[model samples]
Target chain A: MSGHSTYEPKTGFERWLDTRLPIIRFMNDTALDFPTPKNLNYWWTFGGILALMLGIQIVTGIVLAMHYVPHVDYAFNSVERIRRDVNYGWLIQFMHANGASMFFLAVYVHIFRNLYYGSYKAPREVLWILGCVIYLLMIITAFMGYVLPWGQMSFHGAVVITNLIGALPVVGKSITTWLWGGFAVDDPTLNRFFSLHYLMPFVIAGVVILHIWALHVPGNNNPKGVDVKSKADTVPFHPYYTVKDGFAICVFLLMYATFVFYMPDVLGDAINYVKANPLVTPQHIVPEWYLLPFYAILRAVPNKLMGVILMFAAIAVLFILPWLDTSKVRSMRYRPTARLYLGIFFLACLVLGFCGANPPDQPILGHEPSGFMLLDADINSIVWLSRIGALYYFAYFLLVMPILGLTETPLPVPEGISEPVLSHPAAAPTGAAAAPEKRG
Target chain B: MSKMLRKGLALAALGLALIGGQAMAASEADEPRAPSGGWNFDGPFGKFDMAQLQRGYKVYREVCSACHAMDLMYFRNLGQKGGPFYDPKYPNPNDNPYVKSLAKDIQVKDIDNDTGDPVQRPATPADKFPAPFPNEPAARASNGGALPPDLSVISKAREGGPSYIYSLVGLGFNAPVPAGLTVPAGKYFNPYFVGDVSSAWHGKGPAPKGGFISMPPPLAPGKVTFDDKTPSTVQQQAKDVAAFLAWAAEPKQEERKAFGLGAMIYLFLLTVIVYFSYRRIWRNVSH
Candidate 1:
């Protein structure tokens, strides 16, 4: 479901294949000649960066699986062997472990970029929803992958998170028992987690194919956040974007390599190094950094069931984000008032992440003198702060968007992608050399 | 996209409120902040100091080893390629004379070759370090109901990190209880733990800054003698053991960093060239 292909086979064998299957033509059309928005900026490069990271993870993971033991008794020791005994096994293991963090880092930026530009609006809702689906899959896949290590954090993390599913009312207990394959997290649990962790990335890859397919249908959303009026607004996707994306990918990899090679353990929980024990519980169990925001949401509310609901709802709200943000204007850049709230929302998320990593009831501020009591509930400042953050998180998506979208005044619109390019002298060189060539 | 759809989505989200109830009181205390200084293996170029690790091993053997188990490490591990006692003359720990002697110092029970009965014998290079206690229950029972954690990965396991261990062993005992601080009966007041609660207070009260830890004062000045004639000051011993534990947690860290430095150079150069090629291609077009 792309635009008509302009490709014609040049040789006899190529012609025969083209007529028979057209697979080569599909790649040629999409990669070489597909029209893409020229105004797209460095933010759009994250899609390519993400694709690179996924490929890195898959390759490293395949090699690691060659040596990783998924059995509960052997899993922790096997990882140690990889670190100490295996060839450049250290590099491969570090790359895979740190790769998970890099993947999440890119995905977060990509998701937020879409939000800022209103890329999820209108015809792109299906694409956005598919992205959200991939995100959910990634989370599940990462969680399962974490468990396969079978260390203290891995085992206990599996116990704590899997137990959250038991908060469901009627069938929850049965589902939990069924999931564990017995009464509690045991050998069977580790085995299943390993199997699913390996399988989920492929499912994610499948959905990614659809996400890109959907993008090709409507083409890309640009910084302008407006539909392309003509071919003038677009250029062939290959040389232009490929070169830019390639450069961005390299820069991204440079950062990732620094982490993988030097500070491999920085992003990991220190407790995960200890082998799993059923009898002892860590003082505080934290999920990986990527899951912290939602973890904060879960802990914000006191009720177990309600906390679960809110945590799930935080993600659920993202699915309907397109409908919630009713603004006629697509980009938040042009909506001054909306920008303010979005900035606050960003900090709120960071604070939530910080709180999630720390003890909930730990005093955020200095301890007071002897008998200071204003509100008994306010004793734990950090927990109360997280609650406020959670409140704003929900209200931003469900409340603020609907009210602001219809009310805010958007700046004057550009007639086409070239409007600003042509008006500004510094950018005019590009418009003069480039826009007409595509527009023709 | 439509009014009904919007309402439906909102209602679904809004319905989350119906499940709202009170939160469980947070049962956590502030974790100790890791004391920061440059570690030998801190940067991209850092490597483990072999001599320091040897000293650390002495401290572990003399003090911490009584209660803690380092299950993953064998006596031979100390003489392996990246380990502290590793000698270039004998790269394989199994071939190292020092490791052989160390292994033979401990006895392990194994099935007898002829009689098929469990028998005790001196450990060889291949044997794992014997635990001080046979099982978890025995270990717990001997240690005032607190199981001294396994040391093989303790430097990597605890939140405040190996540096925190250094702080605890070297400086933790020096911290006096604040004027208002009142530690409970069973807990020892150490700055590195969750915090010592007051004897009269329930668990819900605000945790003091200097937290509760189970281990009594273990390391002290002149506690362990160093074979290399390094003075066994508490600070020196603490740092050495911390260094050794870091090595135990990930012995290949030195090699990893060395390779990283080279890889970083190659990648930075390759990426720079790729960046230039990107610019060259983009010169004809603009975005």
Candidate 2:
């Protein structure tokens, strides 16, 4: 993709800057004239969508920080004041709040697209690892941002998550105390969280630059999962991808705006509207929807330490996925058996999220007091359901990725991108025999 | 298809079946689900009815305000765009005479500038809605340890919003208390309230539908007279106040929806244009 620079400095000022910086030439090589696989699909557009979401969150967040108060007493009221008094503050705040959910949605799609195409394999492992780092930062950033409002859920969610660290052996309690800046999640905690919340997005942005730079090295992996072999198999990224990504981005924005305007708080917990009270805890405390799968994994095991370890392991496992997968072929499109396992893996993650939202004792199968016990807990309960989901979640990586990849027979892959694109019936008029020439 | 894929699909189908079955079989054992129906502001196109908001305000002022506080609200909010008393001619809500007059009726605690002493003053349009108590401790003390939540965003603060408010206040009291259910001294039974009533229920088929709520049934027939001459039944008052709470929760809702329409149209056109351009640019490349 970065074979040779094609940009020329036509103007006097451009030539001067080209000699000094050559940033114009860099942008041209990476973003404009970079040779990308022509067969990339809508799934590829999520990269651009995620970039747009990060920008939206940062810009809106900076504006929110201008008026937001970090003190526990004033934080709740200040947020309300922004909504009630400041001009278009409601719009800005809602966009920022809902933008977090939207950001996660796009990132999940992008991650899944990578998995399906084996984009994490071989030369692209560093690119995938950089993405994982960004994701971890995003989770921390979103968690801290939720605490800034000093709502009931915000306070309790912080307490619950921070306490998970205390499950460790010796230094756990000390670490928790240090993190809180006191004995519990209090004013000091809120102040530090607000400061870090403002800082984390910029950190995520820095990592994102590395992620993109790593991406440019190997370019994009298309749906075909085949490497671009010749000039005919590729197209200039500028007009080819820019317009397609722009179209997809507009459609995504339409959905985002619908949520921002019509049902801004649908994704948010209603309990969050209540101001934080140290004495009283909410009956049921759940993390934001995006983190539910991990939360479910945390609660699935009965042992506290083991559950914490397992939850962290779930994400840690993804970092080593490139090594776990042993398939010679990259794309699931050519691997029928692996595709099924991946589909089940997808469903398992969704089930875990569903279970996470519910209480551990609540039934997901038989009625309550049914006397159906599976080990220590009821077989009917959400804990059992989550355990099953978590089991499959772990197995998908450790078992399916390692075992199925070696055994499954992949469908024969095309030699080049143009072979399948030209041979496909949709590419030409119905009556045509041989593939037609590329349009001028 | 491979044997493994078939087995995976079978497992997925079985799991889906169990989930679907549970979803249909799950009973409302904790509290009755709040019924949401016939509200003017129900959907994407829904807008607050101004007259209904005015009536709702009367109910809030007369009833709920005695215990609850709307600390986030200001007198100017009532006269802002999409508010009950909004006037297009008066763009600035602070300049709206109706809002000013309404604010003047309430006495707010303040400090005397020169004397350095506490004083009571007539509230201005800019003033926040006065709380019923001086502080949370006092409020809880007065209400028998049950703190009345702020009503500024009550509609968005609860699970079902306006519907939950209406049900808990208006219809909850109508349900007959199950035999052997012990109501707490200060708490009244409301079927729409969420709680574990198993301890209090000694003689029930499965403990009743609801739990003990601190607030007694607040709305009554003819509790507050509407200025618009609408009938002042308990149901009507509850509905009106709920609508008012919804508007108070997000005064800019109508404005948001209105803006969303223009945004949707613009995005739709932009998408269409971009889509066409994308097609044209990639026309030569089959993939």
Task: Estimate, for each residue in A177-277, the C-alpha lDDT of model 1 and write its tens digit.
Answer: 99999999999998898888889889999999999999999989888877787877787888888988887887888899899887788899887887898
Write down the TM-score for model 2: 0.92
| Distance from true location, Cα of B17 in model 2, Å | 29
- Evaluated on the second chain alone, the candidates' TM-scores are 0.82, 0.87
Clashes of each: 5, 0
Cα error, residue A170 of model 2, in Å, equals 1.2
lDDT of 2 at B282: 86
Q: Whole-model lDDT, candidate 2?
A: 0.84
Native-referenced Cα lDDT, model 1? 0.79
CAPRI verdict on model 1? acceptable
**Model 1: how far residue A118 lies from native, Å:** 1.4
Please write out the lDDT profile of model 2 over residues B52-94, one tens digit for every residue: 9999998998899999999888899999999999999999999
Q: Enumerate residue pairs that collide in model 2.
A: none
* lDDT string, candidate 1, B134-208, tens digits: 888999899888888888878878766667788777777677865556566666777656443444344454545
True contacts kept of each: 0.46, 0.50
